[model samples]
Target chain A: MANDVFAKSLLTRRQALALGASAALAGALPRGALAADEKVTLWHGWTGADNTTALNGVIDTFNKGGKGVTVEPTGYDWDTLFSKWVVSSAGGRAPDLVLFHITELPEFATRKVIRPIDDVVASSGLDLSQVPDAGRTGVTFDGKVYAAPLDVHPLGFYYNVDMVQEAGLDPAKPPKTGEEFLEWAKKLTVKDASGKVTRYGFELPNTWATARWIWFSLMYQNGGTFLDDKGLAAVDSEASQKALQYLVDLINVHGVTNPEVGGNKGEDAFASKQVAMKFIGPWEVNLRMAQKMNFMTAQLPVFGAKPAVWANSHCMAVSKQPNEDKLAADGTFMKWFFDNFAAPATTVGIIPQSKAVRENAAFTGTEQYKYFKSFVDDLPNIVYEPLIPQYLSVFSFDKPTPLVTNLQAALSGSKPVPDALKAMKEGLDAQLKKG
Target chain B: MTSVASQPAGRSKARRASAQEGGAVRSGMTLAAYLFLSPYLALFIAFMLLPTLAAVGISFMRWDILGTPEFIGLDNYRQIFADPLFLTAIKNTFYFVFLTAIPMVVLGLALAMLLDQKLKGTAFVRTVVFLPYVVMVSTVGILWGWLFDKGTGLVNYYLTAIGIEPIAWLKDPHWSMPALAITTVWWTVNTNMIIFLAALQDISEELHDAATLDGAGPWQRFVYITLPLLRPAMALVTALTIINGWRVFGQAYVMTQGGPEASTFVIVQYIYLTAFQNFEMGPAAAAGVVLLLITLVFSLAQMKLMKAI
Candidate 1:
């Protein structure tokens, strides 16, 4: 019904688009006719205070760059924006540019709603060589570059500095291996006389997909992937099972984590010193800063064989346009964005994907950078979202789905770890069959 | 109950009523009646009927709304029945209704009976009890969520103050549904109270006095007189609460988000996620249609119950 209403609205908007395009050629109506004035509209999900301010700073500079192209950006939270994009693109009228993670490209590109940026990267004057291999690979799908690489935000280990120092552990050095992490957790955990926990060492996020992200990082480190070469379920393999069992043990066997905490509530728990350590993304930097708390972030400890942490990049993608002029104009702005996003992005508290910005003294010299320097150092070791379109159907943030829900089922002790793994395997297999 | 003899009498009566205003104006009045109903009729058709018909039509097809819709017949319905989460959602919804509807009616009547007496501060107490009903569901959800929080919540503070252990009200699967039920009952029970109170007030004081004069006790009088008299109001409250129970979405969504292991996941949330999140429009539509049918059957049964009363 929502799509039907959007489709109905698109009918009028199509005629409006036609009228606007021709009118631009006719004469200048405010922002239309400058002979070469390229107008690009952007839809993004950066409504956070720091991110939005940083974004606005970037846009204001670009709009005033005298490039003969004026850019307009609209902000919504990702969930609503994605739904709107699905409906609008189906009606053959999507935004000129969309800002999202590369993982979302499959959901759009499989239906040809979005276009490849391969043709535009050089055309838009972006230095593709400056972007890292992981950055570029994460954006590629079906042998085509789907989006311009942006910043990488990996799952970070946040801990209370005061609490860690008081626990007789060096604040400068954090845990680096699974065994060390467990030892540190046990050392940091505080309990009362009657066997009640006064402060938890870790917060096991049983309600949201952050814990799932941690599990994914484990799978990657343990040499597992979502599927095998023939596109079959490899998620229930020993690599994956062994990885999740460690986190499960933290809840059931070790009793170090606060099992009752939801996904985002751990931040509050961290602020109040109820929990000493939590694994989440680098976006948490701004939150703790606002609270003026003594906290710092480090790279997630290796839970498996090699070093890997769940990470993804926020990118700029172009929608399929009806005319070449719109696409070209969008490309022009997108190129400018990749070239200039680095400096402003540092203040936004994300790891720079561009090698040029990251190596600069100005980039690494910020007072805030000290807290997340591990993210900068561990950028290359990060593992991005699994490049499957229907993957979101299996696991989603904050919502109940097969994978996230079952993982929580295990963590909550409602189901055995192996049985939960089997349920997720079956769920993924069923979704793959549907596709 | 109309027989063949009643049909001619009805026609003659309508004719006489129309004829008293004279022949010239009768046709115009009928035309005016249609003119008056046109706006509402047009809105109902445009806003309600067409969308409903389109939903049912779409239920039979597998449309992602991005590509062409394929005619899949009853595959979506089959999938919904086979989906284990749908069964859980249905069971959770029923749990919510049972925990809410009957308890709300009984508690509402109990409060109404207390308020019906002309005690001092009756108006103040009535206003206090009814204040939460006017507050929004989302606000109530957030407020109650804080109250029910396991750590620093007022609920836990009081629970442990007198030597009771604090329960994880929203995080435990066993307690999430009851917590939502408590929030819902506190939010909307005043509607049931008002309905029962109106029925109680409509009962004349003379009847109770007569019962007392006839040597009947207050409890006996309530059983023999007030209880039977409140039957129609009870039917209305029961039907309304049941319908509202089946439609419970906002509280569970705002507070628990159908969590503590999806124990509070309701059918509406399932339908929503199926359509929007997974983009399985056919299955979502099928779930929606199933909900419509379930609600319709219950509504019809309630109507029959009302008529029997």
Candidate 2:
């Protein structure tokens, strides 16, 4: 009923006229809102317990809000969802809505299976002022918006308070420079009687974006973009190599992080206090909070010339199905989900991107906000992976793909750093040539 | 349990029915064979034969899964051949085959021969050795992943206890493939063992007795007599082991995911990446065809070598 009231008071022109206010924000509703009934299928890769519950709650509320749209949601792991969505799209049986990383928008857009929602958003008089500029820009390709931005997930610097203080470093004053970071991490590293590392200062888990996120931040701080303007690989430059070599040294030369990796992943090591400090993302933040860790979020250090950290956003997109009803439902459901997302997001500690939601006293009054404040504050320094179609697979933790393994190889002291970079450069150039 | 109980019952009933129709032997048998074979034939055409034929055709084309296919005339094959990663995958796969197949065949024969010595707990040992084969590949991979952990794993703990330095089993490119090979051999060596065990039990006591009567020592008699008889079974296990080695996917997929540095990135992993993950069906199909030819040539050569030996 909240959405029905929302639809009446803000989405439709009739209610605005009756309320004697200008119909400035209520020119038209999407066609699905005007439909008798439509069931919209939505797929996303958010299967974590809290995320699942929160998302299901959001979907449930949206369905009962008298929007004439019923969204049936499915959850899968990211890789499975990606391959399945591609095949499903090729077969002309794609779901009405899909949640995708903003970086993936280009590939889907290039396929022409998902349409730009900018014109529809404009015609329907949907409010856009609340969405962040990064959120807005991330979804737009060639001046056309492809998705409604949901949340931006930046890597938050997670540190164990007990360990930091034990090492005589102030937890409040997190390291600000690469030199300071090394000194602090060296101090934090603990050794046993026989010379085995009892506790690591920090661990760089060689999976997913744990390593890539830091590498990206370091690259940006050193004034290096992953890809140059011409869409060719640029990470082989001196700045990028300097950044990568630093990460490699942490495992090899520094003696802070061990040559051998962490117990499961970086998060597990951090959560269990085997590692004192490391970078973690929002997905782990909620889970870590639930586990009641004595940890805090801080800004990632300035490793090179300036401040930077890696981030990406999850966005909801509409499919370009020929059927008007389904397409309209996709739009209607996406808009509704975008608007009403704050409740579910706040419940599970997803940093709400909408300005109106972020500024709301209702949201500001929550406990999760305190933990999320640092990431929100650091949004200005966030750099997303370059919009390349191969970015996901190329840098994915899983197999046969080039970048992540090569990244691991360099860090684990398996391949020479120069050889690893050369491999990545060649793969990137090949992908670009195919394009 | 139901499947196990019902299978023999169904086979015996079919045999009884065939016995009753024995008077109409040749004509009836021809019709009956066709009727019984049709289901398998249909399935073979639809799933295996048709897809294999399509893959062969697709190897010569250019298709991005979502896009229309274009006949590029061996371009995909040329691309695969030129790819350094494909070469890496080939090298890694051969490395895996050497690590896994050799141990699977050798250790299996040794274990079976030992069991044939009528050692105490032979039944228990056989069951224990065969247990892992019954477990799913994914489960075995996950279990071994924990055991092979770099920091706190059992493998490292045991290594350190003996004063050897801890090795990064899953995370180091140098050691990751060996780790995968160990896991694979542990999981499926039982298949080769069971095959050899059946063949070993078929060997009569008379050969050993005759050799003893001729004054041949135990080692000589076993080598000259038992080994000669075991050649057929050895060739079978060797061929199967080599073929299975070429088809190694689930072990690498589950444990290393073909990495630390793609040191364990086997051929099937590459095919999976190109076919599904990257959606380049043409190159993936080409790689698959290449894998088939390699496996066929390698298996035949392996069997012939075993026969000559």
lDDT of each: 0.81, 0.81
For candidate 2, list the clashing residue pairs, or say none: none
Which lDDT tens digits does candidate 1 get at residues A1-435?
Answer: 224323534546765675467556555444533334466889999887778888888987887565777788888978778878888888878888999887777877886778888888867777777888988887888999888887888888998988899999987888998988998899889999988888889977666567778888999899887687767667788988988898888977888986675343322567667788998887778778879988878888887889988888888888887775776677778778776666566767787677777766766777767766878877878887667777557556635677767777888888988899898888778877776
In angstroms, give how far residue A240 of model 2 lies from its true place: 1.6
* TM-score for each candidate, following the candidate numbering: 0.87, 0.86
Q: Cα lDDT of model 2 overall?
A: 0.81
Candidate with top TM-score is 1
Per-residue lDDT of model 2, residues A19-63, tens digit only: 344234335645444444567888998887877888999898887
Candidate number with greatest lDDT: 1
Q: Mark the 10 consecutive residues where model 1 chain B has the least summed lDDT.
A: B1-10
Q: After superposition, which runs of candidate 1 have C-alpha atoms over 4 Å from their true positions? A: A1-39, A262-267, A342-348, A359-365, B1-41, B111-140, B194-229, B306-309
**Which portions of model 2 show Cα errors greater than 4 Å?**
A1-37, A119-126, A206-208, A263-267, A343-349, A359-367, A400-402, A414-423, B1-24, B113-127, B203-229
lDDT of 2 at A20: 42
